[model samples]
Target: MHSRSLLSPLARAALLLALLLATAPAMAWGRLGHRLVAQLAWDGMTPAARAAALDLLQDEPDPSLAGVANWADELRANDPGLGRRSASWHYVNLAEDGCHYDVARDCPRGNCVVAAIEAQAAILADPARPREDRVKALKFVVHFVGDVHQPLHAGFAHDKGGNTVQVNLDGRGSNLHALWDSGLLEQAGRDEAQWLEHLRGLPLRQGAGLGPSDWAEASCRIVRSPGFYPGRAKIDEEYGLQWSATASRQLRLGGEHLARVLNGALGG
Candidate 1:
């Protein structure tokens, strides 16, 4: 009574595997997303900014914006001391305040992403700072700019930015934060080049002189939107179809914003 029964043994096995994979939860943006953001920023940067960034990265292996885009994320494994110190710099919990970012209330010691972006941009802009320090700042700027754009990174503190909000995505277990971070984007099945091409087709709207706080606020608003957190703990195909566009838009916008930050700090 079933179509699968008509197939050969190997054919049915392949069909079953295909269905499983189609529903399997793939890792989202993660390194790939970061690199996409970095590459997009690099492609959008001014010639002067690119040159300055290159000079700063000359001493490193793989000296490109995309090359070091994930440095901060890997700091825990590569540089544990700095990693521990900067652990909180990647996000801010603002859902408690109606998605409003009050510097004093949200970021007490300049530890959150919004503050981190401002501080790193300042360091990158200062000509007198040690070159080594400035280089690190450059890397941080690239990574944090991308982080601030991720909705959950600017999401609620109650659930640790949705990291604890578990859900069943496709047929596998995942979390809300992970869904935004890389899962939704991964569902598109576009490689970096494909994503770049897709993003390039979208307009890079000019922000009205907005900065990191503004960016974080925007992401917070997305989290606060209706149904951002699914009522049921199950993520269906339609969920990815609906939210993937927002995630891609964020990645593109993150690229544009990172370029602006680098251009101002390094373009001289």
Candidate 2:
């Protein structure tokens, strides 16, 4: 009877292991499983940059608006787990901590993403570091570059920047953050590349220009935009058109900003 009691714990462990293994494949999909945006950036790079970008992407691999739809489709095809988890809340903690700070607290708006990028930069620059660390850092840099482009991720502290504000997404109950993160991408449809191309064609804001600092500042401004809110629900045709346009503009800016940063970092 004592031996039987000891065996029960082992049996439970075996059951737990089996459950984890059964769900592992499903969990290995969507933005959480693979770094979709980082992969896209890596794939789109020149041969010289590709090698370095691969190293950067190893640590972080979340997708951007331009690639989320494609990533989602691939996730649906390859793993059932993608449907269960939402990547929208990955940066929620940053928003909660950084936004609405008086002079006392450090603002996370630009600092959070910057820290991640700097970590990658350090790994890339350090020759003594293990190759694995360099590789992981590069990947993290790639992923964080995309993160800084997300306006809500740069938002104010109050209300957790819309995470607390529940709303109906096309009549399906959801929240503001989810609507911005994946819903907007989903609405853009399956043709992510074409949509991205269209966005790239928009005229740049003259003299607005782009740099890492500029991008960060722009994101902060967007986060503070009056249009960004939780329960102020207005999904009319005009609102849809405006919001889509805004999202497209932001995506283009993000890609362009990422390209510039990579080019400068690689000394190209």
Query: What is the alpha-carbon lDDT of model 2 when measured against the actual structure?
Result: 0.46
Q: What is the lDDT of residue 51 in candidate 1?
A: 92
Candidate 1 error regions (>4 Å): 1-28
So what's the TM-score on candidate 1? 0.88
Q: What TM-score goes with each of the models?
A: 0.88, 0.61
Tens-place lDDT digits, model 1, residues 44-161: 8888999999999998898999999989988888999999999999998898898888999999999899999999999999999999999999999999999998888888898988
Question: Residue 209: error of model 1 in Å?
Answer: 0.6
Clashing pairs in 1: 28-182, 28-183, 29-182
Q: Please write out the lDDT profile of model 2 over residues 195-260, one tens digit for every residue.
A: 445554665542425444445556667666666663355342233334666665666555555555
- lDDT for 103 in candidate 1 is 94
Model 1 weakest 10-residue run by lDDT: 1-10
What lDDT score goes with residue 86 in model 1? 92
lDDT of each: 0.81, 0.46
